[model samples]
Target chain A: MVSKNQIKLISGLHQKKQRFANQLFFAEGVKVIQELLQSNFELEHLYTTLNDFQTVHASKRTVINEQELKKISALSTPNSCLAVFKIPAEKEIIHSGLILALDDIRDPGNLGTILRLCDWFGIEQIICSKETVDIYNPKVVQATMGSITRVNVSYVDLKLFLAQTKLPVFGTFMDGENIYQSKLPQDGIIIMGNEANGISEEIEKTVTSRLTIPRFGELQKTESLNVATATAIILSEFKRNS
Target chain B: MVSKNQIKLISGLHQKKQRFANQLFFAEGVKVIQELLQSNFELEHLYTTLNDFQTVHASKRTVINEQELKKISALSTPNSCLAVFKIPAEKEIIHSGLILALDDIRDPGNLGTILRLCDWFGIEQIICSKETVDIYNPKVVQATMGSITRVNVSYVDLKLFLAQTKLPVFGTFMDGENIYQSKLPQDGIIIMGNEANGISEEIEKTVTSRLTIPRFGELQKTESLNVATATAIILSEFKRNS
Candidate 1:
């Protein structure tokens, strides 16, 4: 049974400011919660309709009814379980290998999907601009499907970070060299831009390499690929021959 | 001005049954509405806050306030405009070149993203299982951006359709041959499966070529790519060399 205060706290974690203030974020569903439990993320509490996660200590787990679960769920349709985990302090950027840099990605789902793609291609580090959506957003946690535990994501001043990095910075542009023809390196930062805008100007200036995924469709009226799918193709190209 | 009756009609289009019965669907936002107007889709009516789309006959356009748009819109945050288009009859499936077959894509956003990806890669035909989300779903039309104007999508019995196809059929599987090394054909059907189930067992038998996108992450714990991103990778692979 969850107390009134606990429900308020869990519901408040849906917002970035509240999550930051409490140093905690919650993930719903058995899969994500289980992954968090196995990873370095420290669990604050667990609320569930089912009496699962038997390994969790009695002090940490609360058996709640569906009505109680609905009160704290960020989802429109509440899952059977929701686990709150303390947000670990951002780790030092692992400056090596293929690091993905985001130029103000605003969508939580896109960020989450990109993280899953990074995990699939073995790209370990992600550097997000200060304007990017928070990784702890409930929608992002749901979209990541457990990949949140596998990647290291850090939000920083992207322009400053790009200026100082020794690694080659890559960003896609229409007038840039074709990605299929370009020689991609194992160690570089691939910058994906905002949904409505391509990479911001200051970040574009820091890009050492500019690449383009050539459009194959005949009409050429299709404006652009969604950022997450664009990242998929770019990552696949970079990893295909390696 | 949007009348009470008009608002009810537009709101009802949110459901597939109502859309089909009325033989109409609505798209929100200026870009999507503009694309639909330019395409073969017949404009049933348009409701907008702005006095834009000067080319549209004034008789077909209704200027309404944000509050009125909110009552008729499917989105939580309504866009500036919503346009209802008569659902065009499905076109004949283009038999040649690369085709994307969705087993049972349930999410409207994924279907929209895949359509956009198909447009990017010049995959002209999309065959969807009957269970797949309707292509004319407002969320899909929104997510497609403008690509909905270019791609041809049809719903069919995917199992029977696959069983009779003359072209080589391809589907991704964990144990399938490495896609990067495989000799991908210029003409084939690439089947993307359901969000949760991957490919159904009966449909799996019809796949003549089994391909896999190799995982590069070191942990090997990452399960699978999201359906839309996976579609991007597969479509990119097919077009990169062609």
Candidate 2:
């Protein structure tokens, strides 16, 4: 059974300020909850429909009914289980592995998709700007599709972070080095920008290397690639070459 | 002033059956509507609050006040312009350039994003399985930003289409060859599968080559890349190497 406080806490996670104040976010879906349980992320409270908590991992979890689960779920159809987990503490950047740094990315879905991309490419650390979409948004959580466990997302001053990093910051732009021919560093941050605008002007100024995914057609009418999709392509190339 | 019939017709285009029956689709926003005007795609009607249309490409455009523009808009919040255009007939397969075939892609936004990707990567045509989402869906239209103008999308009996195509048919699978190391053909039909399931079994049989975007993590729990993003990466690599 869910208590009033539990419902309130879970609901509060929907708001960015509330998520920040509590330093926790909610993840639902049976598979997503199970993945969270198996991962290193700290679980605050887990609510499950099964009284017995059937899965081997779910055994340690708390049980609740469908109604309780639905109340806490951002999804119209709540999964069998829901869990609240602490936001993983900021970890020291290893700085050697390929990291993704996002500048002023406002879309939760985009950030979540990027997180999934990072997990796919085995990108260890995503050093995001404070202005980047909060990783813990329920929508972002949904989009990550259970990748939130493996990848460490840290919010930092993006402009400062980009300037301080020793490795070359490769960012995308209209006119830049042809990615096919460019020598990609084995280790560095790839900065993606906001949906409407590329990277912010301040962040763009700090980029050491400007790279472009060469356009295919002869004509110059097609607008820029979707940010998440662009990340996937760029990451695939970088990982493939490395 | 926006006529009642115009409102009904614009609203009706939102559905797949209606779009097909009416032989029209709608596009919104300044960039999207402008792209349709600039590109070779046929525009049946153009309504805009902006005056720049007459100065450049108002081939057969009508000027409307912001209120009328709002009345005709399909967006959540109205934009400055909206246009209803004929769904350009899918051009005959030139059979020379790279092509992408989608199987049962139910999401309109995914379809639109894929079209944008197709346009950006210079993929001239997309062959969709009969069950694939409608290309004219307003959400798909909105999501494409503008690339929908350039990519020729056709729905066909994928089986028949695959049987006819002379180029290699490549499909992505978990057990397939590493896309990076595999010998990718210069021109072929890349068959992207259904959203929930990978490729359909019938179509999978027709795929001459099977390629996999290898996952980085050893654990097999995380969700694979979204179909749209995967398409973007695959198309980019195909074009890049070619």
Return the top candidate by lDDT.
Answer: 1
Candidate 2, superposed: residue stretches over 4 Å from native: A1-6, A48-52, A55-71, A76-80, B42-44, B47-72, B217-223
Report the backbone clash tally of model 1. 0
Provide the global lDDT of candidate 1 against the true structure.
0.93
Residues B1-242, model 2: lDDT tens digits: 56788788888887888898989998888888877778887778777777656744555577779777767777768888788888877678657778899989998878988988888888888999889987888889888888877777888999998998789999989889888887777778999988778898889989998888888746545668888889987887787778
DockQ of 1: 0.87
Per-residue lDDT of candidate 1, residues B182-239 (tens digit): 9999999999999999999999999999999999967978899999999999988888
Q: Give Cα distance to truth, residue B110, candidate 1, Å.
A: 0.3
Model 2: per-residue Cα lDDT at residue A222? 75
Q: Residues A1-242, candidate 2, lDDT per residue (tens digit)?
A: 77899799889998989998999988887777767878887877778787544654553467887888888899887778788889887778668779898888898888888888989888988988888888888889888988988888888888887878888889999899988888887788899998988888888898899999888876656778889999998998888876
Candidates' C-alpha lDDT = 0.93, 0.83
